[model samples]
Target: MKTQPATTQIGWLGIVLLLFLAACAAPPNSPTPSPVVPTQAPSPTPSPLPSPTPVARSLRLWVGEDAAALPAIQAVITNFTQASGTPITVIPKPPDALRLSVAGLSLSGEAPPDLIWADQEILAGLLADGYLQPVRASGDALPGLQTAATSQSQLWGIPITAQNQLLLLYNRSRISSPPTSSDDLITSSRAAQGGLVMVWDEPYWLVPWLYGFGGSLTAGADGPPSLNTPAMLAALNLFGELAVAAPAEVKTYRGGQRWFGEGEVGLMVDGEWALSEYRSLTETLDLGIAPLPRIPATNQAALPLISGSFLMFARDLSRDDLKPAEELAHYLEQPTTQIELALALGRLPASMEALADPRLQADPGRAAAANQARQAPGLPPTKAARCALFGIDVWLPSLLKGNLDQAETAEAMQAEAEACVTQ
Candidate 1:
């Protein structure tokens, strides 16, 4: 152990010398190596909150049972339902009876309807009763139509369909073209076996004649009814002349309808509402439509009262029902829907855009009616005024039947109208 070989001794001494040299060569300022640490897995991402689902909604709409307009309205409602998730229930009621029906429903504590599709005359009464709510609109409408739907300076209803006027319907087989003047109509009728026949006694039909002579039921909107005037006398004289010259029918509306259908008259004064019926009769009769004939004295076309139908929201809608009601109402007023409805019903459009449609432009009859409506005067919103105007029937039959003289007839007519408006 004490005596070792020279190589072994030298190797041991070399290892000791190398270890001392390495220790002396190391830098004093060098950083020590830290212990290795593992990274924790990333925290799982938190889940997001769920979004709310939309609730389904539905509404009931009341419409007059006008065969001419009901189908068009239904088609529009169908399209609206497809576009929106809401469903609509259309209830048909008699136009004249709608006011009564609404009063009954509302009084019975039943939800009357989200909307009432009544004409302006009916809307006037409903508005008076506080049964309608104002609509929010961002566009303009026909001035006369806007007037008809407005009450107390507020827009109470949205006019969906207009162009309801007393139009002159003729049998195209007898008349090649519509007569431009009442004189021409008289001459043409004299040539035919049966001449022009109209629902003359009804004030709804007679107002056009009154207008032609520059007479009106009321002086202006919210004004007292002015039934007796020089204009009224002139109009009555013309009425008498027509009754004597033309073949007058006794029962106004039904008689004119029946006679026209039976080919008893060459020309019939009717409304746009009768277009469908007359069109159907084309299988046997060639029917044509034109604006009322011109009056020579006044130099004015017989201006039928221009009015419109209202898409009114019921005043008693519940909070939840209002959303769908407003949506449907707004949808009904869209240009596309208005255009479609106007085209289908052959009614004039309230939308300026819809009025520009080429289809409407191409229809001469509709264009003529539209032109007349553009110039026609609007009636007052007073129900009494309407009643007074219609009273022309009561005394008219007696006058035509020779039971009263012209002076007495005028007196009686004036008295009846005055009494009505005063009431």
Candidate 2:
């Protein structure tokens, strides 16, 4: 059952790895950076790639970051513009919209944005469609992040932060310690003040429970439909059980946030992206962050979906158009810039050096976020995953509201997702 040789039967794997060196990570102190081919990127484009054309233009950056996070992000851009004296314009959009927007703009005859700061999950779709050019990063980013940003085993973007991770959060004022297992979480959530769990009624929040119990949205890891498994039913049942055990008073996400801050709800599930907001509540709320507790039946912790912001490039960038973007990207990767972002935004740095900096070491919350991230299976950015994630987001509410039972919900999800790929 051996596959053919590379020159004969090479699949997307070969093209993906061809974008950058096989050794994704570079030596910490390597004087020379790893070789990469932007034109040869992850897409299986025809050979005799066109030569680079010089274009004189300021870098256009489209960032998919929350409004509260823009200030810190802006500070970095300000430094880059000031240091390099390169004129740049910045625009912010929703993370989920960045990919679609970039793809649409490419087809409209308008030159694509020169740069993007977005979730790593969008890279696979972009690369699969030949919308992005691979980057020759310094390769000093955390191995976990490099892995997350890679699609089909190819590196397409440089990791900016290991920050988009879900973890169990509780208030020390209400509970002395965080729960380490599911049974404990249920008991503690019941005993906490207000006796209500601040739950996010969304699929992103349900992924860990599904994965922890061996349920999957896709068949095997290759992303075919297989949602109607016993494990999925069990996971859905577990989620319903927790929701029933602690009735929620707040109906909206913002309401839940308000309640959690007011100490009305002590336990919740949230991403590390919320660290800055929660860290500010130190005066009134003693927040504690921990990885999702292990399931007692399986003895496996829920698998967080790990991903982070990335610095990505447009496919059409000429050598001249790319210079400034590359300069800014490299500048963002520096230990100083990463450390500054870590402190100002309560984020986990992608740079190993910045992550180990003494200043960042003092923040226990960041450490907990990193621990949870380490336990994640990472957000798969494949085309199949992109399709499945959409179906998951669409079906989560029906399952949570009890409009669809576990079996019914799983079947609907499978059918809907299979339809997505087929169409």
Q: Which candidate leads the pack in lDDT? A: 1
Cα displacement (Å) at residue 225, model 2: 4.4
Please write out the lDDT profile of model 1 over residues 1-423, one tens digit for every residue: 588999999999999999999988867777889999999999999989888876675688889747766887888898888888788888888899888888897477866788888888788888877888887654456676776776556787787877768888888777788888978877776675447677666677777878888887776666656666777677777776666545544455677687777677777778876777878876556887888899998898888888887788888777887787778778877777787888887788876666777888788667767777666776656665575575676787776677886667767877887777666
lDDT of 2 at 397: 81
For each of the candidates, the C-alpha root-mean-square deviation to the true structure, in angstroms, is 10.9, 30.6
Candidate 2 structure quality by residue, lDDT tens digits, 1-423: 987787755666776777666568666884787799568558676899788974446788888888888988988899888888887778887877877787687476855687878877667667777888878788478765776666655677888877777778888888788889878877887773634454446777877898889776566445576666788788888887778645456788777777777777778887776766987987778988888889989988887777777888888778877877888888888888887887887788887767667776677777766665555665555656666766777786898877998888878877777778777
Show where candidate 1 strays beyond 4 Å.
1-48, 54-56, 67-71, 81-97, 106-109, 192-194, 248-264, 280-284, 318-327, 361-365, 402-411
Per-model CA lDDT versus the true structure: 0.76, 0.75
Candidate 1 lowest-lDDT run of ten? 243-252
| Candidate closest to the true structure, highest TM-score | 1
Model 2: lDDT of residue 52? 92
